[model samples]
Target: MNRLPRPERFILVDDNEADNVFHEIMIRRAGFTGDVLIFDNGLDALAFMRQDELRVPTCIFLDINMPMLDGFEVAIQAAPLLEGRETTVLVMLTSSGSPQDRERAAQIPVISGYVTKPLAAALVRDMMSA
Candidate 1:
């Protein structure tokens, strides 16, 4: 199977501090030696993404329920920023398994995947290999 190159950066946007920490650990355990950025809210993550010097081949794990802007809102706003950036992966790493949520995510062109919460090392490895 053809595998995409390893991402140069990982961004975690979620309100839960514990989840962010655990996800960061999992990413490291998955053998990711690149930068890991954690944001407690979506607005901050968007701000970082809008920076002029943002890097490519970045993976963003976004949560569905967040204050100031939900996952869908962030994804919508991020679409333009991610335009033509093929290596950039935006996955909804949410706890909600609602069919509505999944369908909503599916409608977003920029969102590449939807994963349940408590990101695991194996899952991270799979994401990297994809």
Candidate 2:
């Protein structure tokens, strides 16, 4: 994969621990040498996003289905923190490729893209460029 601009930090919000591990490897393979912050749930991720004063994430890979709060809920709640923050991108990363899900993502202003899971290095490269 071609090199892409590395974000200061990459945030991954997924309940699945194994997926987080795999995605981290993919991000690195895409030549992203930055902090990879993993969150098991949306609430924690929302909190982190709200509290972190220093840097806004370069990219946020959020799962559609998760415990304690789904990705949509997080996006909705984080919209205030995310709006007009051009450098930050919120992406829906999930196993489901349902059209309904995609439509919902469209309704959310914060979501830049909706991608299926098992994140690949190529996809990461494409996303970074996007």
Highest lDDT scorer = 1
Whole-model lDDT per candidate: 0.87, 0.85
How far residue 28's Cα lies from its native spot in candidate 2, in Å, is 0.7
The local distance difference test score of model 2 is 0.85
RMSD (Å) per prediction: 2.1, 3.1
Residue-level lDDT of model 2, residues 1-130, one tens digit each, is 1122446778999999999999999999998887899999999999998887635447888999998788999999999998877668788999989999999999998898888988999987766665
Error of 1 at 119 (Å): 0.7
Q: Which candidate wins on TM-score?
A: 1
Task: Kindly list the per-residue Cα lDDT of model 1 for residues 13-114, writing each as its tens digit.
Answer: 999999999999999999999889899999899998888355567888999999989999999999999867766788999999999999999999888889
**lDDT, residue 130, candidate 1:** 72
Q: What is the lDDT of candidate 1?
A: 0.87
**Residue pairs with clashing backbones, model 2:** none
